[model samples]
Target: MNDNSKVLVALLAGVAAGAALGILFAPERGTETRDKLNDALKNLGDTIKDRAAEEIDNLSSLKEKIVENIKTTLGAAEDAADQAKTSATEPA
Candidate 1:
């Protein structure tokens, strides 16, 4: 996985731990607590989705850069082969 993936995982783990602790220490009755937790979860889910979209964009850009570099290197190699072939076939 990439750096963004690692960071995202760590952030999600921290949020889950914090949510668990909030539930353990909550002061309200069942329904109220459930409602509050549900709201919090919805908000957190939205934030997570936004961050995940950004990470996906970063990953896509990284992939493009890698592919471009490969193409450039391959082109250089092909040119070198063509030069070598021409030298071999020409008069000394």
Candidate 2:
């Protein structure tokens, strides 16, 4: 994974840990505590899914741009070669 992804994962882990610890320590009934923790976990999961989707889209866009640049470069080279060949064949 990239540095940005690593950092994001670490930050998320820290947040999850903190939330769990905080909920565990709060003076509340067992059912209430479990419910709160469950909600927190669900929210975290949704955030992770959203971030993953965004990253995938970003990567796809980058890939497309790279492919386009390569194609353009190759096309320019081919055109230059064709011009050079035509110039060589012309009478003086």
Candidate 3:
């Protein structure tokens, strides 16, 4: 996989290991540990969702810029073509 994927995998593995260790050494009861795990998972999920949304917004913005560039290039080409046609049809 790519570097980003590798890093993400490593980070997830580290988080899992750390959580396991924390649970093992926790001073609280099972219910408290479970609650903590649940909260951690919910937070992780929210973070991933936010990142995805941000990436989507960035991609959308890039797409709009590309489209605007294409339109401007096409308009320039059309203008040039019109000028060439007018010159060709007129006296030298």
Candidate 4:
């Protein structure tokens, strides 16, 4: 993975850890604390899923752009080669 992806994963992990610890330490009933923790975990899971989808879309877009550039470059090269061939065959 890239640096940005690594950083995002690290940040999310830290946030999850911090939230779990904070909830565990709060002076509340056990059931309430457990419920809060469960909600926090669900939220984190949703966030990760959303980020994964976004990353997949970004990668797909990048792949398309790269393919287009390669096709354009190949076409230009072929055109140049054809022009050279025509010029070489023509009479002076």
The C-alpha RMSD of each candidate to the native structure, in angstroms, is 2.6, 1.1, 2.6, 1.3
Models 1 onward score TM values of 0.73, 0.91, 0.78, 0.88
> What TM-score would candidate 2 get against the native?
0.91
lDDT of 4 by residue, 1-92 (tens): 99999999999999999999999999999999999999999999999999999999999999999999999999999999999999999999
Number of clashes recorded per candidate: 0, 0, 0, 0
lDDT (C-alpha, whole model) for all candidates: 0.86, 0.98, 0.83, 0.99
- Across residues 31-69, which tens digit of lDDT does each residue of candidate 3 receive? 988888888778767766786687789889999999999
Off-target runs (Cα >4 Å) in candidate 2 are none
lDDT of 1 by residue, 1-92 (tens): 77867887798879967986697588878888778778778878888899879878988999999999999999999999999999999998
Best by lDDT: 4
Instruction: Compare the candidates by TM-score and give the number of the best one.
Output: 2
- Candidate 4 local accuracy as lDDT? 0.99
Q: Provide the lDDT at 50 for model 3.
A: 83
* lDDT of model 1, residue 73: 100
Model 4, backbone clash pairs (residues 3+ apart or across chains), number: 0
Alpha-carbon runs more than 4 Å astray in model 3: 1-13
Worst 10 residues of 2 by lDDT: 1-10
- Sequence-dependent TM-score of model 3: 0.78
Please say which candidate is ahead in TM-score: 2 or 4.
2
Q: In candidate 4, list every pair of residues with a backbone clash.
A: none
Q: lDDT of model 2 at residue 53?
A: 98
